[model samples]
Target: MKAIVSVKRVVDYNVRIQVKPDGSGVVTDGVKMSMNPFDEIAMEEAVRLKEKGKITEIIAVTIGGAKNEETLRTALAFGATKAIHIKDEGEVQPLTAARALAAVFKKEGASLLIAGKQAIDDDANQTGQMVAALLDIAQATFAGKVDVDGNKATVVREVDAGLETLEVDLPAVITADLRLNEPRYLKLPDIMKAKRIPIEATTLADLGVTAAAAVKTVKTVPPPSRSKGVMVKTVDDLVAALKAKGLA
Candidate 1:
C-alpha cells in the first residue's frame, strides 16, 4: 500500500509575521520558512505506518513555486520514499491545493492519503476534507490516533465535544492533529541526505488539471495589540475597572 502525504511551506512558527506595508500580504522576504508544523506530524505518521508494514511506499507532495521544494526535501528526510512538486507560480488557494492534491492522489494510485488538519499560516482546515470530497472517498479529520488492519483503518479524532473513534475503509483521507504523534528531529546526516534526494517537479498544466477559481484577499492586517493591564490593589478596584471597560 502506498501513502501520499501532502506538505506545505509556510513561515516558521517562531517568526513574527508582518503584514506588507500596502496590505497586500504577510512579508516573506528574509523571513524564516519551513514545512508546515501539522504537515510534519502528517509525515511522521506516514513514516510510522510504513515502519509498521501498513504502507509500502510514502510519496510526499507539495504545491508552490521554486521555494516549496525545500519543504518536500524535509519530507524526504522524514522518511518519504519519493517527492512530487506541483509547480504553481501564483497563489494556490485552499480549493486549488485540494484539486492539485487530488490529482496527485489519482496518478499515484495511492491507497492512503494523509495531510495536516490545518496549516498555521491560514488555519483554513479545509484542504484534507476537500481532497476527500474530490476523490469521493472516506475522510477522517483531526485524527489523534490511527491503526490500520487490512483495508480498514481506525481513527480517533478530536472534536469539539470529545474524542470520536471512526473506522473507515481503505483509500481514505486522514488529517493529522497535534496529538497524533511527536515528529522526530532530523539529524545532521539526514539533513545532508535530504539535499541529495531528487524531487520530481511538474506543473499543474502537465497534470492536466486546473484548480478552482481562487478567492482573492482584499487586504492583510495584524491582530490588534493587547491593551495594557491596569494595576488594581483591591477587589473593588478590579470590579470598577472591569465595569469601566464594559467587560464586567
Candidate 2:
C-alpha cells in the first residue's frame, strides 16, 4: 500500500493576525508559517502506517508558494519517503486546491489519501471531500482511528453524538481528526537527513487540469466585539439583571 498525505502552510497559530490595510486579505508579511496542526496529525498517521509495515511508501504533497517547501520538509523529517510541491503563487480556494491534489493523485497512483479534517487558517473542511469526489472514491472524514489489513481498511470516526466505524476497500480517502494520533517532532538527525531528500515540483499545467473558476472576496469585516458585563454585588443583583435582559 502507498499513502499520500496532503500538507499545508499557514500562519503560525501563535501569531496575532491582522487584516490587510487594503482589505484584500489578512496580512501575512513577516508572519511565521507552520504546518497546519491538523495536517501534522494526518502526516503522523501516515508515518505510523509506513512504520508498521502497512504501507510501502508515504508521499507528502502541498500546494502553495515556494515557502510551502518548508512544510513538506517537516513531513519528510517525520518519516515520509518523498514530497511533491504544486507551485501556485496565487490564492487558492478549497475547491481549486482539491482539484489540483486530485490531479496529482491520478498521476501518483496512491492507494490512499490522508489529510486534515480542516485547515485552521480558513477552517474550510471541503478539500478532502472534494478530492474524493473528483476521484470518484470512498472517503471517511474525521477519522479517529485507522486499521489496515490486506486490501481493506477500517476507520473509526468521531461524531457529535458518539463514534462511528467504516470499512473501505483500497484506494480510499480519509480525513483525520484531532484524536487520530499525536504528531512527533523531528529529531536533529532526521532533520539533517530530510534536508538531503529531493522534493519534486510540478505545476497545474503539468497535470492537465484546468484552473478552477474564480472566487471573489467582496469584503471582510471583523467579528463583533464582546461587551463587558456589569459586576454584580449579590445574587439578587445578578438575578435582576438576567430578568431584565430576559435571560433568566
Candidate 3:
C-alpha cells in the first residue's frame, strides 16, 4: 500500500514574524522558510512505516507557489520516494487545500494519508479533517502513535481528555501531533540526493479540482506589546504588586 504524506511550507517557527505596514499580511520578503514542524513529524511517521516494510511507497505532496518545491525536496531528503507539487498562489484556505489533496489521493489510489494536525502559520487545525471529510474516509487526528497491520491501522490519538485508541480500515487519514516523534535532520548528502529525485509539478485544474477561499482575511496586525517586567525584592513586594493590580 502507498502512503501519501502532505507537508506544508511555512515560516520557520523560530523566526519572529513582522506584520506588513499596510496591514495586509505578515512580511515574507526575506523570512526564513521551512517545512511545518508538525508536517515534519508526519513525514517522520511515514519514514518509520516504510522502514518497517508496512508501506511500499511514500509520496510527498504540497500545495503552494513554485518555491514550494523546496519544501518537497526537504521531504524527499527525509525519505519520501517521490514528490508532487501543486502549483498554486495566494492564501490557500484549509478547505481548498483539502480539495486538492483529495483529488491527488484519488489519482494516486493511495491507501493511507498522513498530514500535520495543523500548520503553524494559520493554526486552523482543519486541513487533515477536511481532507478526510472530502474523501469520505475514516480519520484519526492528533495521532501520537500509529501501528499498521495489513489493511488496518491502530492509532493512539492525543485528546484533551486523554489518549484515545482508534482502529480504522485502510484508506484512512491520520494527522500527526507534536509528540508523535522527533523529525530527523537532513544531511548534506541527502539534500544532494533529493535534488535528483523527480518532483512532478501540476495544478489544481490539472487535477480537475477547484479551490476557492471560503474565508477572507481583511487585515493582519501584531499582538499588543507586553508590559515591562518588574523585579520583586521579596514576598511582600510581590504580594503588594499583585494586590495593586487586583490579581492577588
Candidate 4:
C-alpha cells in the first residue's frame, strides 16, 4: 500500500504571534516557520507504518507559495521517499487545498492519506474531512492510534467524551491528533540526503484546478488582553468580587 502524508508549513509553535497593525492577519515577517506539529505526528506515524512493512511507499505533499518546499524537505529527512509541492501563489482556502490534494491523491494512486487534524496557523480542522468528502472515501479524524490489517484499518480517535474506535477500509483519510506520536529528530546525514530527494512541483492551474476561497477573512484581531489578577486575603473579598461580576 502507498501512503500520502500531507505536510503543512506553519508558524513555529514556540514563537509568539503578533497581529498586523491593520488587523489584516498575523505577522509572518521574521517569524520562525516549521512543519505543523500535528502534521509532523502524521508523518511520523506513516514512517512507523512503513518501517513495519505495512506500507510500501510514503509520499509527502505540501501546498503553499513560499517556504513550502522547506517543509517538504523536512518530511523527506524524516523518511518519506518522495515529496510533491502544489504551488499556489494566492491565499489557499481549505476547499482549494482539499481539491488540489485530491487530484494528487488520485494521480499518485495512494491507498491511505494521513494529515494533521488542524493547521496551527488557522486551526480550521476541515481539510482532512473535506478531502474525504471530495474523494468519497472513509475518514477517521483526530486519530490517536492506528492499526492496519490487510486492507482495513482500526483507528482509535480522541474525542470529547473519550476515545472512539472505528474501522475504515483502504483508500481512507486519517487525521493525526496531538497524542498520535512524537516525531523523530532529523540527523545531519539525513538532512544531507534529503537535499537530493526529488520534489515535484506543480501549480493549481497546472493541475487544471482553480484556486478559489470558499471563506473570506474580513479581518483578524488579537484576543482581548487579560486583566490583572488580584489576590484576595479573605473569603468575603472573593465573594464581593464575584458579586460585582454577577456571579455570586
Q: Which pairs clash inside model 2?
A: none
* Shift in Å, residue 41, candidate 3: 0.6
lDDT per residue (tens digit) for residues 53-117 in model 3: 99989999999998899999999999999899999986789998999999999999999999999
Error of 3 at 70 (Å): 0.6
Per-residue lDDT of model 1, residues 53-86, tens digit only? 9999999999998999899989999989999999
lDDT score for candidate 1 against the true structure? 0.94
* Stretch of 10 with least lDDT, candidate 2: 214-223
Question: What is the lDDT, from 0 to 100, of the residue 116 in candidate 3?
Answer: 94
Q: Indicate the worst ten consecutive residues by lDDT in candidate 3.
A: 207-216
User: Candidate 4 on 159-247: residue-level lDDT in tens?
Assistant: 99999999999899999999989899899999999989888998888877787667989999999899999899999999999999899
For lDDT, candidate 2 versus 4, the one ahead is: 4
Positional deviation of residue 9's Cα in model 1 after best superposition, in angstroms = 0.4
Candidates' RMSD to native: 1.4, 1.6, 1.6, 1.5
Superposed Cα deviation of residue 187, candidate 2 (Å): 0.7
